[model samples]
Every structure is written in structure tokens, then in C-alpha cells.
Target: MIRGEVIEAAMYEAMHQAAVHLPPDVEARLRMALAEESEPLAREHLRVSLENAALAAAGRGLVCGDTGFPLFFVRAGSRTAVDGGFGAIRTAAAAATARATRDSFLRPTMVDPLTRGNPGTNLGPGMPKVELQFAGDGDGLDIVAVPKGGGSEIFGTFYRMLYPADGEKGIKRFVIDCIRDGCYAGKICPPAIVGVGIGGSSDLCMKLAKEAALLRQLGEPHPRADVAHLEQELLLAARSLGLGPMGSRGVNAVMALHIELAMTHTAALPVAVNAQCLVGRRWCAAIDAGGRIACTGTLPPRETEAHA
Candidate 1:
């Protein structure tokens, strides 16, 4: 069985990694854009971004001052067992967030909504949102830590109960309009990654859009052809708007666009657009039933074996 202590340590390490490191796929896209950018100012922006990434990877400082919200996505195997069960998982997350804040890897960003009281540990009611799912071979656990910043969250939009008549054209129009009106102000950060969700309840649609924006690797196309086409079209349309890096006028306005879809009721249509800043922060780890751990993007090595 996987020990609760091990899980906690892994999560702590993941939090640190998420704060300090940029994923390889995202870094690669930035580098490619940097190389191709002709405008001197835009190129300079890309250069600074790359330098910041390098410095953060070297453990010198954070990639961004605002470490944003801590979000965790977990996929647990059916047969996998945790020593302390589900509560143990949440306890681990809270502990990890607290530790990250103390170590200066993350800022204490959580506060009481009504009283505006600072928790100072990044933990409070409904903070560090966790979503759990069952997938894979049912013998392991997969966890991804996503640090979503406030700027991008501000640009997130949801439209519910649209007529079916709106169809594909309406969906595309809504997405492009959001980028132009809401994101192009340089508030959400650009050459941003955009995720579009369709055909679910409002909350579910937003959740799917968030996942697509933060989790989907750069340059990876959606599996479905129709969805893939929409992504490509949206990417082109967004670029054509001339909202370059930080909304400067340039050729590259968006790094990637992804769409996730689900079945909805016959008459109602729900859609959401979620955006991620240029500095995408995410790290993932997997632990097998045997307690073997594998992780990427700055997560530290597991220090102990699982209990038998």
C-alpha cells in the first residue's frame, strides 16, 4: 500500500516544482517563438521570459511573484489503497501548501472571502481545490499540480443555455470575441494558452476548459477531428487579431488553443473559455501500487519505499 507520508512528501515536492519550473513542452514553445520573432521588442520579451525560466529552474527565484492558486488533479486506480484514505490525501495537500509557503516557493494567497482574513498558510475553506477521478489500470495514482494565476482567471468566461441554433459558428464567435474584448487588454497575459469547453453544464464546462488550458501539452492536437479543426481555426483567428505577446502587435498572438467537449441536453448549450498566462506552471507525479514514484518538471525523487 502507498503510505500517507510518502504521498504527502511527493505532493510537497510537486508544489515546489510547480512554483519554480516550467514544463518542457511550454518552454519549448516559448523558445521556438523567441527564435522566430522578428520584432525587437517582442523578441526581448521572449528573451526575458526564457531567462526567468532558467533562473527559476536553477532554484534562484520564482518564475512569477504571484504563485497563483494551487489546484490539484488526481487519477486514482480502482484497486489502489492509501494508508490513511481520502482525508489523508487532503491533509497531505494542505501540509504541502503550508510548507511551500514557508520555504518561499509559494505565496500565502488564500484569504477569507467575507472577512478578508489572511490564512498565511495558503489553506482555508475551499482553497487548493482538488478534483479526483478514476482512470488508468487501477493500480497507480496520477497527480498534477497546476498553479493558475489570477490574471488568467479573470479572463475566464462562461455562457450557458445558448440556443442550439448558435451551433459551431456561434461557438467560434464567442471564443474569438472573448479573446479580443477581454484578453487583448494585456490583463490575462499573452501569447496566452486558451482552452474552450463545450456541451456541458456551466461549471463542468469551465472545469473542462481549465483542464484543457493548463494540462494539455503544447503542440498536441485534440483526438477528435472536429474539435481539432476548431482549435486550429481559433488559433488562427486569435493570431489574426494581432494580440501578440503582452498584447503587443506581432505575428504570434497565441501559443496554443484546445477544446474539450461533452454531451449536453438537447436544447441547452454551455460553453467556457479559460486562459493561462505565458508562464505556464504545472508538474505531475505518478505512484504505483508498489509505491514506485515517477514525476516530471522539478519534482524531487521519492525518498522512501511504500509499505507492504
Candidate 2:
């Protein structure tokens, strides 16, 4: 069976790694944006970002100050036997989040919504958000740890239901509006990765958008040709708006735009938008049935990477 310690240790490492290291794909996009940007202020911001990434890589500090949500997306296999049962995953996540906060890899940002009480451990009721799924028959568990930032969640998220008649034009218009409003003055941190979810229930649409933004590799397109084309269209439109890194003036406004779709009610179309800040902090690990652990980011994209 996959031992609890193995899971805990892997989560511990994943948490810090995600916090401290900018994912290679994200860094590559940033470097490209920096190369293409012309505005002096925007270029400087991009340069500073890369420098900060280097320092963070060298153990100097976290990639970003707001480790907003220490989330664990666990994709487990039905055939695998987990030691201490599947509850061990949540236990490990809580423990890992606590330690990460204590060690400064994560700031204590989790709080009670009603009382605004600080837990100091980044763990609270429904906190350290864990999204679990049982899929595939392989004998292992794959965890994607994302320390989602507050800037993105608070300022860069959107949802609405549209008349099905609004069609593609309406969807495009809404997405552009979201980018314009959310990324203004870098409130949501410009040059962000945008994810759009269409046709799902309200909550599922939001979750889909979030997962697409956080878990996707930079610039990866949807497999469906129509969806991919729409992504490209929205991306180009965003660039034409003259938004640059951190809301400055240039062509490097969006790092990437991804879309996910699902079948919905015949009369209504629901849409959601979520963005990941330029930091794009996420790390992955897997544990075998025997409890052997391996940390990696090169795994194939999730089967649910795109629904349409």
C-alpha cells in the first residue's frame, strides 16, 4: 500500500517547490514576453520578475508574496490501495500546509470568511482546498499542488449565464471585457494566463476555469480545433487592447488563453473565467502502489485537461 508518510513527504516537498520555483513553462513565457515588450516600464517589470525568479530558485525567497491557496488536486487510481485510507491525503495536505507556512514558504493567508479570523497554519474549515478525483485504473496517485495567488482569485475571476442566442460573438465580447476590467492597473497581475469555461453548470464552470488556468502548461491549446481557434482569437484580441506586462503598454498582455467546454441546458449558456498570475506557481508528484515517491512536472496533461 502507498504509505501515509510517503504521501506526506511528497506533499511537503511539492508545497515548497511550488512556492519557491516558477514553473519552467511560465518562465519561458515571461522571457518571451520580456523580449517582445517595448514599453520601458513594462520591460523593467518583466526583467525584475525574472530576477526574482532566479533568487527564489536559489532559495532566496518565495516566487510571490501571496500564497493565497495551498491547493492539492489529487488524481487517484481506483486500483491502488492507500495506506491509512484516502483520508491520509487530506491529513498530509493539512500537515504540509502548516509546515510550509511555518517555514515561510507560504504566508498565513487562509482565514474564516465570516469572522476573518486567521488560522496561522493556512488550514481552516474548507481551507487548503483539496480537489480529489478517482480516475484511471493505474496503481498510483498523482498530485498537482498549486499555491494560487490572491491577486488572480480576487480580481481575475468572473462568471455569468448568457442567452444561448448570444453565440460566439457574445462569448468573445464577454472575455475581452473581463480581461480589460480585471487586469486594469495590474490588479489581477497582467500578462496572466486566462482560462475560460463554457457550457457547464455555474460551479463546474468556475472550477473548470480555475483548473485550466492553474494546471495547464503555458500556451497549451485545446485539442478541439474550434476551441483552439477561439482561444487564439481571444488572445489576439487581448493583445490588440495594448495591455502589457502588469497593465503597461505593449503586446504582452496575456501569457496564454485556454478554453474548456461542457454540455449544458438547451436554453442557457454558462461561462466562467479564471486567471493565474504571472508567477504561475504549481508542482507535481506521484506515488506508486508500493509507496515509492517521485516528484515531476512532465507528466501527460490530465484527461480532463479539456472537455471540448
Candidate 3:
């Protein structure tokens, strides 16, 4: 068996790269919008958005002030073992974040909520929320790192309907309602990419919705016809909101509205909407039995351009 330390070091490098590439996804999505957007204002907004990403990349800093509470989703193979445990992985991550913060001049957003004093480190109890999945593969692991900012997360919402029999329209309406409520405060950071999770328990629903944002290539729909139809229809309605990038009031405010649904108890119809800002910073890397792993950026590559 390969030593776990090798696996840990590789994962750390991947996570660090994930943070560095934060602006790539943002730039891609904005460029895609610019191509498809009809409004001059929306196009201009996308241009500025792209420019911000470029600046971040060139300057090597977080594109936004809120680096967000970090999250790690790990898939570990059966034969592989974690020698230092997850705490070690998290410590390494905080060190990477500290380095990124200093290099980027990002404000230290992690402070003790009680003493009103700053611990000065981004490492909170669960700040780097780690989710581990044990896959029955050889000795390796896969890690997905996401730095979720609050600006977009405030738009995340949950609801419980009378029952699941409320069906598709009900689910659609519930999602639209979430977007409406979230944006009512104009803080969701528009031209938003919305993720909806239906039928899971409230907490699970929220988790699924955020996970949905990381599903970059699995686009448009599930293989099921009815599910695909609902995805397309809801997407159209969401874009119709005219909330355009940053809720500036223009067309194509939404890039996509993604949904994941599951059956629940007879009396439950739980739903959640997880919204994302224009700069979606997410990356996924896979480690196999040989302690080898690689990360593609989190979220889909911009539909318009690919980074060299």
C-alpha cells in the first residue's frame, strides 16, 4: 500500500490550485453570457465581470472579498487509508488559504463569533466542511474543494410543502418562490445560477443543492424525459426574471436553474434552492489506488472559452 502521506500532500496541492483558479470559472460563465446575451447592458456587465476575473488571475487574489466557508467532498477508495486523519488535511488546507490570503491581500474573514475577536485563521470548527464518501475502489481518494461565499449562499433557501404529490409545477413554483424571496433583498448576487434540491430532508436538501452546482458536465437533465422537461421549463422561467447579472434589471439574469429530486415520505415535499454568484469557485480532483489524483476546476468550464 502506498503511504497516506503521499496522498495527503497531493490532495493539498490540488486544493491549493483550486483556490488559485477561482477566477477561471467566473470568466468562462461571463464570456458565455456575453455571447448569448442580447442586451447591451448585460453584455457590458459580463465584460466587467470578465475583467474582474482577469484582474484576480493576474494579481493572484480572491476575486471577491468573501472566500466563503470552505468545503471538501472526498471519495476514498477501500484499500487506501488516511494516516494523519482529516484534521491534518484541514490543517494543510488552512495553511494554503493563509498563503493565498496573504498573496491576494484577502481580508481575514474568519473571526471568533463570540469574543468579537479574530482567531486570525480561516480554520473554524467546520469552516472547511469535509464530506467523505468511501468508494469501493483501490487505494486512492477523490477530493472536491469548494469555497462558498455568503453573498451567494444567502440565496440558499428551504421549504416544506404539504406533500410530494404536489408534483412538478409545485416544485417549480417553490423554486421560483425561493428565487423571488432570496432576491427580494437584492443580496443574492444575480445573473445567478440556481440549484434546487427536492424531497430530501432540509439539511440534505441544502447539501444536494450545493453539490448540484459542482456538477459541471452533467448538463440539461437527467436521462428521464419528465425530469429533463422540468429542468428546461424551470430554466426558461428563471431567466425570464430580468434580474440580469447582479440583479441590475436586464434579460438573461440567470444562466441556468439546476434541480435534483428524490421521493420522500407521503406527507413531505421538501425543497431547497442554492444560488451561486457569477464567480463560482469550485474544483474536483480524483485520487486512485496509486495515490494519484487530479482536479479539474469546480463548476463547468465556461461554455465559451477554455483556459490554456
Q: What is the lDDT of residue 123 in candidate 2?
A: 89
C-alpha lDDT of all candidate models, in order = 0.78, 0.87, 0.63
**Candidates' RMSD to native:** 4.8, 1.6, 5.2
TM-score of each: 0.93, 0.96, 0.83
Model 3: residues >4 Å from true position, as ranges?
1-12, 22-26, 84-107, 113-116, 136-138, 184-186, 218-220, 298-308
- Model 2: per-residue lDDT, tens digit, 37-132? 988999998999899988988989878888888899988876988888889889988988898899999999988888999979998888788898
Q: Which candidate is the best by TM-score?
A: 2
- Candidate 1 backbone collisions, by pair: none
Clashes of 3: 4
Model 3 lDDT per residue over 1-308, tens place? 43445545554555555555553555566677788777776677777767666666675454666777666776655677665664555665556556545554334566667876766656666655667666554466666666667878855555555465676668878887777666653467666667877776777777767766555533446455776687788778877776666666665556666776665677787777788766666667665556566667643222221210
Model 3 pairs in collision? 139-289, 140-288, 282-298, 283-298
- Candidate 1: residue 84 Cα off by (Å): 1.9
Which scores higher on lDDT, 1 or 3? 1
Candidate 2 residue 262 C-alpha distance from true site, Å? 1.4
**So what's the TM-score on candidate 3?**
0.83
Model 2 alpha-carbon drift over 4 Å, by segment: 304-308
